[model samples]
Target: DGPLARLRDRNQLDRADKARNFALAQAGEKYRECFFRAGLDPLRTLDPSQEVKSAFSPNGLWRCESQIENLQKFRAAREAIPEDFREPLAAIVLEDREIVDVGREIGAYKDAKMAGAVALFILRRGLTALARHYRLISPTGAV
Candidate 1:
């Protein structure tokens, strides 16, 4: 599960907080899909048993066409958002980093509480923008 799933499972985010808010969850899924399909995810070296075999060899001569297309889409999506919001969005959505760590990296919070709050706010806004870019929801707030 990604950060959004973890948040939802922990009851931090409810499906019905507002009708529009549900789009955030859908957006998160799309963001993760793009990241995965682009082949940007890090190799899992921590646990050899958990590793899945890839069709492409380590020499990188074989390239998947879908992965190339997804990489273009991912780059376009990333370019659609504000520069400042990108890091936090990537950290949480793509890298699965904690909000607190993102907050610390952002570097202006007086306390961890404030840092987490700000990071969460940035993540939500970033995902909302992504949702519109993906057309998972309309620009006028219709899901």
Candidate 2:
């Protein structure tokens, strides 16, 4: 399961309203979509045949129009997030990393519990901002 699913299972999202939950899910899906479209997934491996050079694009560094648009959208969504919240959001949403790992990486908490809590909070706020940027949620309501 993903971080969001784990959060829901643990009732961490109990305080969030339906709209906020939907917005968060939408933001996450969009982020993942853009991430894959932009060819930024580190885990994806290209086949040898796919890697072979062709006459059309010898360097194999070509992007379709849709990909270009998604890349722009990805940049816009990323920029919409606050600097403090960006890393955690990307860790959980894009890389599927655990919140505790993210917390440990940030290194500001005295305990693991506190670190996870802070990381979760940062991720939620970042997702909210992204939802607003994508118009999945309103700026002033239910965020």
Candidate 3:
């Protein structure tokens, strides 16, 4: 019983180490900053036990048509952005095209810097559109 208990402890320690390393590797500075600002622990969030859902879930959004619909909307919105707003955005798409391309490939490394950059672009554009919808920003994208 003692030997078995020791083995279990070692296995748990190994798993915890692996999870920590994986979390650290995946959680870039942007993600860490966001987590810190939100008062959340990035490490705990990466734990498998704390993971809310599995990729194989039958009801997961990625497995549904709604996901495709949402992606289409995202694409349309991206395409609809005015030239002025696109000027600032061009730097990211142009400089980090490879990174963004890889990030978009399969949603792999969700917290990667490249993925975060792409997400940031979407979020900034979404906010711009939302502000426009409310008339908070001009059509030229000025606040």
Q: Which residue pairs clash in candidate 2?
A: none
Provide the TM-score for each candidate, comma-separated.
0.76, 0.79, 0.27
Could you tell which candidate, 1 or 3, scores higher by lDDT? 1
Model 2: how far residue 39 lies from native, Å: 1.3
* Best model per TM-score: 2
lDDT of 2 by residue, 1-143 (tens): 88866775555643547657766767877887887886555464432224423532456654577755776788788889998887788888877888888987886886889888878888878888888898887888455
Q: What would you estimate as the lDDT of candidate 3?
A: 0.38
Better of 1 and 2 by TM-score: 2
Sort by lDDT, best first: what order?
2, 1, 3
Model 2: worst 10 consecutive residues (lDDT sum):
47-56
Candidate 1 whole-model C-alpha lDDT, 0 to 1: 0.72
Candidate 1 is scored at a TM of 0.76
Backbone clash pairs for candidate 3 read: none
Between candidates 2 and 3, name the one with more favorable TM-score: 2
lDDT values for all models: 0.72, 0.73, 0.38
C-alpha displacement of 29 in model 2, angstroms? 1.7
